[model samples]
Target chain A: MVVIAHPAIAEDSMPRATLRAILGMRLQRWPGETPVKVFVLADETPEHATFSKSVLQVFPQQLRMAWDRQVFSGQGQYPEVIASTQEMLARVASTPGAIGYVKASEVTPNVRVLKIR
Target chain B: MCVCSRFAKTTASIALAGCLLSWHTASHALDLLDGDFQLHGFASLTLVSTTDNNLFGQSDNQISKDFSEVGVNASWRLTPALQLSGGLLSRRAGGTDDGGVRLDYGLLDWAPMSSEGGRAGIRMGRIKTAYGLYNTTRDVPFTRPSIILPQSIYFERTRNLTVSADGAEVYVERFGEGGTLSASFAYGQPQTDTEAAKVPLVGLDRPGKLDSKLAPDLQILYEGAGNSYRLAFTALRLDLKYQPGYRDILQAGRFRLTPLIFSAQYNAENWSLTSEYALRRTSISDFGPYFYNGTFNGQSYYVQGTYRLTPQWEALLRYDAFYADQNDRDGKDFAAATRLPGFTRFAKDWTVGLRFDVTPQFMLRAEAHFVDGTGFLAAQDNPNPQALRRYWDNFMLQASFRF
Candidate 1:
């Protein structure tokens, strides 16, 4: 798995905690204080499960429940879920402050790969 | 009776309208706001039937459709460190609530200190109480494990008092590779003066109303092993005063309640186990000679399990118990003094339920309950405690939608 972020993000690397917070929607802004827009594959997808377990080290359903609790309680919003890795890559590359993950083989040139600090 | 059903129909129609509105808004609401803003809402309509006493209306042998819940909430990230949020909620649960729209929560959250290691913040306004694992989002159907929450701890009879309070809260969170630790402290005035709050705190026939003092609540939560294991502790103190009306048979009295709760949960891919234990200390004094004046400790707990049959389907089983007085667990002594049935002092309930997520935005659920004792039933619904049956069963169905 390769973690990629829009170029607007200040850090070229991130700690796992910060990454979890961002993916968990607890942290809304990047280091530069720019709004952080998160994108992800559908929860049921193999890519989503793989990325959540390996990169985020969390269960996909846990993330979904967290999102549901937040969204229904008006405390947070759900990350935009894409249907395919192609769409995930395309959106992460185009959208500012976007962050997502893809298979290492599918990593493209448009997005910056973030190192795990 | 006909009028109540007519009103129920009206609320159901409003819920349907809310459903359509949320669907429309979910797709476009974010685009309309600054990139930092979002809109979300949910609606649920429940049909309940009971083998005995009424619950959410005349549920005795007849399907009662009066239970409905609808809410809309919005949040805006005004800045990277500050956010503003609010919600409007309308609940129609038989005679307990009026089904009128009320401000659920309106608050400004400011994080003065934040980092990758830990963060601290304050929220000011009407804030939801951090009672247990589920109190903050208790009104939302999707967030709840069953159509109705475990009544042992989340007592609907006294719900208004703990639902939301108008005041301020401070929260701190620490993030680590091992787990996340979070704590919050809140001081606010509970929403009293409602029948739901009054009937349980005071007597159903009280001549006066209940007024609350500033309540203090504190809770700590730990999520370990990548959110698979959770533990929590909560403590809350409430003080209420009864103001008698002119020439009233009752005298002004004071009641104080302090509750401590211990909660734990274990989550796996296919199944989850959850449980919470609460000890409540209650004191009543200065009600002249006609009322019961004493202090006692109450106990409540529930053990529940949920299994995912598939991605879209789930099953739930729970056994919940409540005792009004720990010392008088059987209630015989209290019953002799008060002339109330001993069964009124305790309740044990067994529940089985199923849920189906028709889609990401909509869901359906059905639940059946076998209950013994009348401890948790609302006095307003029972009217005469002597008339309540010691054993009863209930069946309910609900459809909920959210965006």
Candidate 2:
């Protein structure tokens, strides 16, 4: 799985820690003051597990706990959940400052693949 | 009678609204400001029973359904750097809390400095206290590790003083490759005017009023390896003053509590381990000759483990212990001085629980606890101290849903 972002995001690559924070919903804005919009597939999805473990190097449960702690405490919000990789691609492509994940083979021209350093 | 009916009406209406919204597939809706506005809520009910002592109600012999929580919150991200959020909670915990609706948290979170590397922010208004790990979200069933948190640290009787405060907090975080380190400091007036808060501190609902000075709380946390390892330290102080009522035998008294807590957790695939230890110093003085006055250092600690048997099922085991005074672990001195049972000063509990995730939005849980003492039982639930037992057993079943 590879992380993808809206083509409008200026940075093609970001530090892995920053990427993790973004996906965890702790980081709310991208550089240049663009509101960061994160999308994710359902927790049970294999793609979601792969993206959380391999790409973000965190367990899905950890991510869920982090979101719950923040969301319930009114410190942050949950990411918009996409139904499938198809919807994930479409959302990331259309939504400014959007970030999501897609299989390497399914990468399309609509969304820009983000590289983790 | 009129106010009671009005409250019932409001609760029924909100519950109806929540049920209607639960039917919507998407939890987030009304995305008014380009999806900046969001609403969420949760409802949970529990059935509790105990062999000897009442908890959250008269649960000594039969099941009691007096424990429930309902909450709703809304947030609007007005700008990338600023957001406003608030929530209302209606909690019923038998005589301690009468299911009254109250503001859980309402804060304007502003991050003047923000970037991928880190962010520093200030929250002003009614902000949740960052106590231990679970205190901030303790009311939310889904966020808790068990149906009832370890009473050793999160005292339900004194919860109002620690749950949230009316004031401001400043926080800073650094997102690094090795881990995430964050720290916060808050100064606020704790909620001490409630009957629930009064009973715990003074041992009864005194006619006098209890007021707290501005309390200061501080916490530092480190999350390592994607939260595989978590550690935290917290320090807090609460100073309270009581003014006696008309013809009141008690003089204007002073009570002070200072607690230092250390918490750690290790989360691994399929299983997790967590523990917290606290040292609390309590002092009460100047209640004329009518009340006991002294200083004591209390000790509390708990170790808990949870294992996931399946993707949808989880199991938990925990050993929690508490002592009202470390020097009098068995309460011998206290019992001799007051003629109260020594068991009231200490508790040792063994708990086992199971959780089933029926759906992403719904969950069911059951737990059983065998307790050796009544140290943590709320006086409001069991006003008669002589009725308490040295040992008891408790069982609880809960159903919770959120959207």
Candidate 3:
């Protein structure tokens, strides 16, 4: 279970509206962009593996070409990776704009946990 | 030098012998207590070629015929919280004997506080600069596909020796149901060698001289992600002064605010895009001794979009532009000074490219650039004024691999 978020942004304060806005920017989605979802890896693995799997689950076929398109077009970067669950929770607790998930028990006073489904 | 070479050869031979012995020993039996404390090393060779006619204003022939570099990276994990690592580089451009080596990352990490999801650790030794969002991750082989980094943002050198300081840092992170945040702080003497006086050349040219002094610097960074968005900010401060070789130089011991960058990217199944804008204030101190200081304010920005056509192929396009205040010399703005070589001070570029991912760790990329030069070059006092305009088209291809 990773612990993450800004030191100040409390979990409850991040309403759906704020979460949407923050994630929209982090995810680089336009105002009326289509519905898209994100996920977090609970177990520890290589950072690249986590990124590849998360992205693959969302857009399986696009995974082959999406990274290159992003690099050349400068649309944005792939998702970031953390070393451990504790690191994830700490990052979420201190970062107001960050959204990551860990084990249910890891939830702290700093960040919110959003369900993928 | 002879002794050093001899020593290196002997060390290599010893290492080879040790490897053979280890192979034989392992084949005989699985001895739990037979593990020996041994030193090991690894090396890499890179070959690069460019088809662009002229790059960054150097003569077409000045391009590297076939740029090759050899380097050794070694590491020893002494304990769960302690390790030693270093690297050395030598390239054909400079003879093998002209290579340089330095401690890459050697530190004692003490994680006094630990939890399933969080830990606070202190690391000391030769620490790398964690300046911007990408600085810490820049050296990873898989980070980017190009041989040339975004020069505008990162200096290509492997080590800023002057800035690599002996110091300690504290890091804290928290991961919640939604996102994560992490923060760190460090203090140390600059690593690169500096001099009190130096001549700054333009473009990729090396400076004629350098100052010798170690200045302390401070940096702060923040990154976060929500259900749909991510945000990051990096700030740095350094103490220094700038004096052009010729002109009424502006000198001040102040922190030059290089720029504050804001970047965001959205991910979707079929498509995604990213945009970044950075604004920096140019003071007299920035235009050191190479050329005259003219218009002192400048800003640069770029936006790009990407669409995945298929699993193996993708397309991309981007527009980048930068502008500077017109040269103000002797109370006269050089905006209209066509007769003077130093009158221009603005520039812009546009680029498009494609990528083919052959595998997860390998990719081929090609990009073309169309650039316009407004004030990039100083005018030559030639009879024909039309000769002052400069422009060029550039093309690049790169095959990158990582493990």
> Interface root-mean-square deviation for each candidate?
1.8, 0.9, 14.1
Over B56-112, each residue of candidate 2 has an lDDT whose tens digit, in order, gives: 988999998888888888888888789899988888887788777889999999998
Between candidates 1 and 3, the DockQ winner: 1
10 residues in a row with least lDDT, candidate 3 chain B: B30-39
Share of reference contacts kept by candidate 2 = 0.62
Q: In model 3 chain A, where is the ten-residue run with the lowest total lDDT? A: A68-77
Model 2 C-alpha lDDT per residue in residues A1-117, reported as the tens digit of each score: 999999999999999999988888778889888899989999999999999998898999999999989878889877888898889888899999999999999999988998999
lDDT against true structure, model 1: 0.86
Top candidate, metric TM-score: 2
**Candidate 2 — which residues are off by over 4 angstroms?**
B1-31
Docking class of 3: incorrect
| Whole-model Cα lDDT of every candidate shown, in order | 0.86, 0.90, 0.41
Clashing residue pairs, backbone N/CA/C < 3 A, model 2: none
Which segments of model 3 are wrong by more than 4 Å?
A1-117, B1-63, B66-109, B139-141, B145-147, B155-168, B194-209, B212-229, B241-257, B269-272, B285-295, B324-344, B374-389
In model 1, the Cα lDDT at residue B132 comes to 87
DockQ of each: 0.57, 0.77, 0.05
Best by lDDT: 2
- DockQ leaderboard ranking: 2, 1, 3
Provide the global lDDT of candidate 2 against the true structure: 0.90
User: Taking the tens digit of each residue's C-alpha lDDT, what string does model 3 give over B69-114?
Assistant: 2333334334323334443333222111222343444445454544
